[model samples]
Target: MHMSPVRDDFRRSQLAIAALFFLLGFQYATWVSRIPALKARLDLGEAQIGLLLMTCGVGAAVSFPLVAVLMRRFGSRLLSVISALALGVVLVALSVVPDYPLTLLVLFCDGVAVGCLNVAMNAQGAALEARYARTTMSRLHATFSAGSLLAALLASGVTAFTGTLAVHFGLAAALLAVLVVVARPGLLTDDAPAAAQDGPDQEQDGPDQEQDGPDQEQAPAAKKDRRRFALPAAATLWMGLAMVFGTVTEGAMNDWSALYLKDVVNAGAGLAPLGIAVVSVMMVLARIFADGWRTRFGDGRIVRTGSLLAGAGLALALLVGGVVPTLIGFACVGLGVAAVTPCVYVAAARQGSDALSLVAAMGTTGLLAGPAVIGFIADATSLVWGMAAVAVSAAVVSLCATRIGWPAPEPHPEPHPEPHPEPLDGRLAPDAG
Candidate 1:
């Protein structure tokens, strides 16, 4: 019945990390809820808007390649705080940017912030989960869904009253920035890879070896570990692909769900955001339950089940097209896609910091591509078909789940005992002393 101090630290860290996730979701959902307003303010066509939205992807592509390097040099904890603050600033700027080009620039910067937060926060989550020796990432992610759900519902009410993005966004930004600053202390300060490195280094250099041994005593093992830390191309690619599929579904919901409801389902302004909110609500509920499911079923099975659920849900929405059925569909999709990214990140983290960063960067492409792809499809065919992309991506995720090969969680390493001193007389030591 007694918990160790390490468990306590991990528990506190989990709450802190979950707060960051919630803040992130709140920020993102606020922006998404206002996209319809921004689209109207700029007087842009669907294709043009989608193209501009792709600027975020451009920023993500630029930033993703740098996550590992930046995380190593600055540490994920610091980077997360810095980036969250920057993202808040960017969100505010997005509200008031006068022209489309400026909006693109601001959005690109927002994308950079998004990419950094993804890497940094996931690093923190993975570290905490590793420390606790259990599945925690999904629950942290569920907090994000809770934030998004709240934001959407709040935006719906606020827009009905005020009809302005700037006021809503500015208030949220100020509050979110303050929360990020307050939460900064609780994040894991050191890189998980660095912690992994420390273990091997201490093992190679015993208490006795520390006094007179040359640094080269551990050179071979250090060199091998360095090699292991190199990005594993195969693992990174598969995990990234899985993330891409999951994120595509997520991105579609974030960027297009409201529009889909408004344009295709013919929902009224008051009801337009309801579908998206329903999605968020279902996602929140699913993620809340995902940790237990992950433990009982493992990542692959859980993700596969979720993906199938999401696909069926989207397919229902596409076929039904009416407001009622669409809401039901989105809710189903939300439940289905909830578990994919959390499980993927947890799996990636087990590989090490390098793999975590690489997989996160790779997965971020879906966030960038999802809106743009949907926009293009909507332009060419119809919003209904564009919505089909969510179903398709969900199906792809289901297919990729088995290939993810969810390995068992890595075992925690035990501390080594100090070596006893040799007697000055040089007699043989007792074997069972």
Candidate 2:
């Protein structure tokens, strides 16, 4: 099979993007496995650790708006490359720093870099997809998930074998260096037209359409009507809610799964982390394979179906007495949540490609907020209620999907033949598996 959409020049750019995303994923949860070490080294209480981690959120939120400027000015390549490299270094710095205040500063920057890179990569990837004939978003995302899985293994192995987190972070940095060498060519220096480069061969493959609307040919208006921290468009709001619900479950698994396995199931300490790891492994696997399923099924259908499965899975985890059932429930939660988030990003980018950075900035802030709120709720109420609250939220996410901001399908105009028949302008067309 061909590596690119049609043996295209931009193939390397797509590959590079895939690699960048993969490394980003690898970095995200590596710290989770190392948190115990961090806690012990810093002599931090749970509350202190929580407060310190919250600074990461603040940094991420603060860095988002700056991405628009970075993308607009220095262009995507240098900005993204710098961010990726910076994060790897900062993570290492965080590991070695002895002072609490210094560690907090390093982590804050780490969070900012993570947040900015997320927006930049999606925007860059979406543009690259426009340059190529087929869809690359889901596959790019799959690559990221692959990296997450790798990080999970590395996390477990390195922690068990050596106490130092710096070595693993150094390896992650090395991967980022390799990624920069591979994926930075053929990408537009500015947010220039996608079709100008990739349009020669790509058949416009939007879902069925009617007569084109004014917005169809022109740029999306997300930045033109930007808001600092306002509610997203109607569709975005619903999609964000879906993410909030899904992430509630994710956070609970990350925090409370081991406890549940130990307390509820009478598992040993050694076995407890195993239960949580199993759930996380399932989640990473689902993101790799199942996330792209939405491109085939409409986002609405996937959201509706996924919610029922997720809710059922969560309920089983709560009510079922057997460990087997709980594991399966967590697996279902993973599978159900995988597609919804990627779908939201795809929708947001497609709808507001011109405002791509702004859309991502807003959406990711919502993304970060989800887990933070969940943790706070868990602390406020009992952890049991927190998990149950997550179950109920899944239903709401599926319900909200029906009302998300997908552009209304257009009617194909019979009288006029269009140059490209894509659903949105360089917004999103499905990628090859």
Candidate 3:
């Protein structure tokens, strides 16, 4: 049977959105894989590098308000494309920036672009789910992990050939440009809230109903004002907390896994990058099947179980204290927490766009800043302790998972009742009740 145009559009949009996710992950991992090189080139201490990361986080944290406004004005589609292009430009700038201050400025800009893209792309994901009534966010996130895996492998390969940031990041940026162009047309244009597009129709409302027109107009404005200052619900806060903790575990590993291998395990330069590769590989594999698990087990059970697995597994690995065990632990962490953020994002989207934006921003902060926090911890104590903190964060995610209200499983449709036989008489039969 031939598919309708709408079906084709949906498929295209889905692929396009997945590409956006992949783009973000690939760009991010390219830089993240080079953290060790950056530290050495800048001749920075762990604490100083942490401070640099903190700057990026600060930029991301402060960007939510601006991102919110931009989303309202431009809609998620345009904003996603624009921010993605900006991210590519920022990556190139990062490669060329010479001084420490200039580099920090570029990173701050990168953070802003990242924050905007994160919120915008996730909004698109939520919209896709709403329109299609499917659980796709997890699979979309899997593409992200795939991108990271590719970047890690590429970084390793490129390092062997040459150690030039300009060459590596330039190639990554070119790839991003191609993907952004390919994905833009397929992104959903009608992603804005329905209320925003439902202009007053004079023909629909009779003269008698005109009296309520002003009130109807004022209602949205009042709602908007209230939303500006309103506090998040307890459930929303819990979800955000889970996101923070979940991302802290994820982000810390992305930034520090190599260093942990190099410094703690003495894995040497050749093997250090594999730490990130291991996590990305496991994350990609787990996320590939996470949506199916969510359908069967529900988001709550999956999150709680996964978080516990991640925390306990990592903690055990640290205790074992060897390169092989540590790599195994990172893989566990990846597999266990792979679905947490996507589940949390789905739950937050159900709350409304405001909560979604807030939670996404919080997650970005965790992803960017959490690694820096680990850096400071490593400086003050040891890298092992810093990784222990990641384990603790994973445990906290499990705790928060228990508290937050997850979406209930969709109820099965009931079977149609059998038709009662017509009464012999002309009159209708009496009700059983």
Candidate 4:
């Protein structure tokens, strides 16, 4: 009936990481749900709004090198807390920005904070999995969806009473501050080094080990060499590609599904929002259960099967050309791809911090760019073709999932009594479901 200190620590770390995930989603949705208010306040047209959104993505994409360096120097725990606090402050700034140019600058900074927190939080999640020899990433992602949904509902409720950005965002930021403080103490420290050393890339012969030099000389060289950015390994590249395509599928749906419903399916104004609602609901539900699926089928099977389901289902919906089938298709896309990014993050983190940072940045780019790309395709051709492109993105994810080297699940280790237990120091372990 009693839990060991190590087990309790694991539980606390899991909660802490989950809270960080929730904060990320909540903070993002809080701003996103208020875009209309922001647009009205700035007197911005659609094109200008697009530009503002794109700036955030640009910032996230360009943050890869910096995130990698900070993760190595500060570790994920400190970096996660710091980036999260910065995100909270930026949220407040977003509510009060005086001009469009200044707003763009703040959003760019917001994106950087988002990128940093994204990588850092996932690193913490990966470390938890490695240490406990369990699956938690999927459920942690579900908390993110839950947070977003909560923010959306809160925004709606607050809008009914008032359209004030300060009231809604101020409340959201305050909640984020509270969550950050609560999560800070429970986060694990000293795990980043273990994760990096246990990564798949560590299989290569290091200069310190392979070169015929003194330990004193080679150690400094090796340390310095690690600080420089190297090209991602083949496996890392494949994982990053999967991440890109997976996010493209997700982001395109959020931006396009409602428009697709209205224009293609000829749905009423009131019913069109259901397109987003269906996908969001199904995705949250699927993520809630996805960790179990990962445990039973392995990460490779989950990614491949889910990606195929999303691509094929959407393609069928587009071919059928009806509202009912289209909504069903959106639901399929949501349910199928819900676990893709989380699974990819686990795989990338196992490749090391550089791989993790690169893959996360790639995902940020896909999320921001995919919808715009789809818009161009729709303009050049038709909305059907645009939707078809999304299906292609999902298919690409499936294909890349096949090429990446997935780690075999580790067997559960026997229980130990050490106050500080060592991590499995390799990869995530599959558990009996």
Candidate 5:
């Protein structure tokens, strides 16, 4: 099929947005891969470490509500640039922090930046997808996983060579900053074009107008437009909850998988990260084809299946309790969650950027909260049981899968009809029917 100029513009925008996703993942994994080293340096216990990790989420949660206001005022494109810069700076600070409290402070700040970056970038991605008039969320998320996988591999190699987080993270921070600067030109400013916005609403609104007159059709549209940037409705809330469940599973694996393997499975430094790599690769692989699966099976089925797989996979790994079995289990977990977030994000984007930010924030809380939950559990019982939280999260997502419902389609403005001339008598209207 021949591509139009508009599609090509969106395609470029998509690439730019995908680059941002990749960088975000890369930054996150770089820090996560170095957690073992940081843990040893601080000599913190499981509970302390968990609480420390929770600070990131706390910061993010605090910032979530503000994202909508920020986006509304400054626009997502600008926020993406500023938040990414903040993220890079915080990451560099994390690498060199001397004390635990300072590290906590830095991580809290990192979480704030991350909160902005997460909502902004995803909102931008959703906007681009809306402009393109198709499903691009999975592919964008796949790029993120790909970045995380690459970063994990690089961190492993860098740790082997430099044996320091400062050098590894410093270089990564510099690279991301430069790349984002270069890609800033391609980021999108608008959620959707006027033409694209009106088209779908027009088609969907046709039947409603036929049932009710144009005046009735327009009242709801005007009301909806007035509230467009306000609070999300019930459906958006449900979507956000679904995001929380999926993110809990994903966040747990990202933050704790390597540490878990090293402490629990007795895997060596080199091998421990490999467990996370298995999950990362599986998630990347699953997402690579998620758009296609979505095309064939639809969002509901993909989410339901992915949720089941994630839960079952984690349970299997936790039950088997070894390096190899755990790896296999995490791999299953990865595949299961690959499609869930992307689908949810896409659904929210279809609504509008406001809805996207609200849902994204809700979902992000789940991701950031997972590590803290696991840490507390591990401190109380064991890391194995703590890790079991991922399985539980997966189960929650499976149950909530049906709640990831589509957004209410926006109403289109009815085209004004041309005026008809009256008859010569000026009393009887033309076309008296």
Candidate 6:
């Protein structure tokens, strides 16, 4: 079991992770973007919808780490399949369930499934370079954002043509059918009960690592425990910060964009999709090339720079409030956040491929934590202030990234030999870079 050949296998594994993100995207896009439509069907007010949205964070918080531990213990392949199927079923429930409380309950379940799926996907993505010696997490997350953009388009399309919940729900189900097929081959990785047997030490390392030494040209068991999570730690903080800023802007667009446009900008319901979908477009484009920036600059510096831009964008939106400034603000924020999650998780993988699960879990917590805190603020104070809170959070994220990844991890051996030489250009970990 020399790990030198695993590089190709790990790269191949990335496609599976991408498809998983795509599937997850199909659901999440609807959650944020479909509010106006959902409000019509459910006939709910702002506060109630806010409460329902909050439930999602609660459900996600509970489910993520549990799934991370399970995926680490059991295996990504199995847990992911189960989680995906459950997510689809719950999505259908979200579309049809008219009862407000029932909808919240179902959304909770959806969050649980999505949270679990996220942990499983990142654990797998991190393993690509973590076990193989190359980059994978950033590209995989780029795919994740791409999937979200795709869903944004799909959502707009569905809204335009039919404007029916049944049609949208059916589309989700159809997408899941394709996802199940694509995900099946990967699911087998988790079917065994082997997870229970793995001790905490083994579980701490996300997946199997059959490699050796601190440098290339392989052998065995100089297995570096490499617990200095500083790089990923910093990356994780920035990621969380990005989520806070991005989600607020995102939440605004999701929950209020249409309303704002309809009321403030005096636009019709149909055209209001521009507010959210436009940002999605920016994010999709940015993720494709963001790594190049990170490679030249560093994740820490880039993220901080992005945060400042995102915060400035928020200010622009707040101050200007007109269509052009608002759009620019949204675009800036989208571009700022586009590459962040990928950068962070990839940093985690680089630290120790074995620790991918733990690091991914920790990283996802930042996502979960930011929303919960913001949701409470939105619930208590005004929504505008809540958004301002997101800006502050991003600034805080910038500070945290600086602290988390300094004195980067010691260099480790290449886990495998590759057809291509490893790219010498790389960035600081996501948080600190």
Candidate with top lDDT is 4
lDDT of 5 by residue, 1-433 (tens): 9866656676788889998899888988888788888899888788878777788878887775577667656777898999898888987898778999999999888888887888778877766544443457788988887788789999888988887778998888998988698779899755432211231244465578688977787777545534754656666677788898888898889889999899998988999998778887888888888877775666777888889988888888888888888898889889999989987876665555566677777786887667778889999999989888879888888777665554222132111122122111111111111
Error of 2 at 66 (Å): 2.1
Candidate 6 structure quality by residue, lDDT tens digits, 1-433: 5544454465456677778877887678766788888888888999998887778867876664466456545566666777888887886777789788898899888778877777667655644443344444556666766667778898888888888877887787778868877756643242122222222233333333434322341122122322322223444444444444444444444445554455665666776777777667777777777755665665666666776776778667867777767778767777776655665555443333233444444444555455556667767975566557766755554565564452233244344354222231122122232
- Model 4 alpha-carbon miss at residue 16, Å: 0.7
Model 6 bad stretches (over 4 Å): 1-11, 30-48, 92-101, 149-171, 184-278, 312-329, 348-388, 406-433
What lDDT tens digits, residue by residue, belong to model 4 across residues 114-190? 99999999999987877776688999998998889789999999999999999888888899999999999999897
Question: Which of candidates 2 and 3 reaches a greater TM-score?
Answer: 3
Candidate 3 residue lDDT tens string, 32-150: 79888888877778987877777777788878777767776788899999999988998788777777898889888888888888888887886665555456789999888688878
Model 1 CA lDDT for position 132: 49
Against the true structure, candidate 4 reaches a TM-score of 0.91
Q: Candidate 6, which ten residues in sequence have the lowest lDDT sum?
A: 217-226
Clashes of each: 0, 12, 0, 0, 0, 13
Which rank order by TM-score, best down to worst? 4, 3, 2, 1, 5, 6
Residue-level lDDT tens digits of model 2 in 334-356? 77766666665655554333245
Clashing pairs in 1: none
Q: Please identify which of the two predictions, 1 or 3, would achieve the higher TM-score against the true structure.
A: 3
Model 6 lDDT on a 0 to 1 scale: 0.59
Off by over 4 Å in 1: 1-7, 31-52, 92-102, 149-170, 194-232, 253-275, 312-330, 374-389, 409-433
- Report the Cα lDDT for residue 269, model 1: 100
Number of residue pairs clashing in candidate 3, backbone atoms closer than 3 angstroms, sequence gap of 3 or more or interchain: 0
lDDT (0-100) at residue 106 of candidate 3? 85
Please state every model's RMSD to the true fold in angstroms.
Answer: 8.2, 6.9, 9.1, 3.3, 9.5, 7.9
Clashing pairs in 5: none
Candidate 1 lDDT by residue in tens digits, 145-255: 677878889888888889888888888898788888778778886554343333223344345346657465456544554564563646556777889889889888978
Question: What residue runs in model 4 are displaced by over 4 Å at the alpha carbon?
Answer: 4-6, 160-162, 204-228, 410-423, 428-433
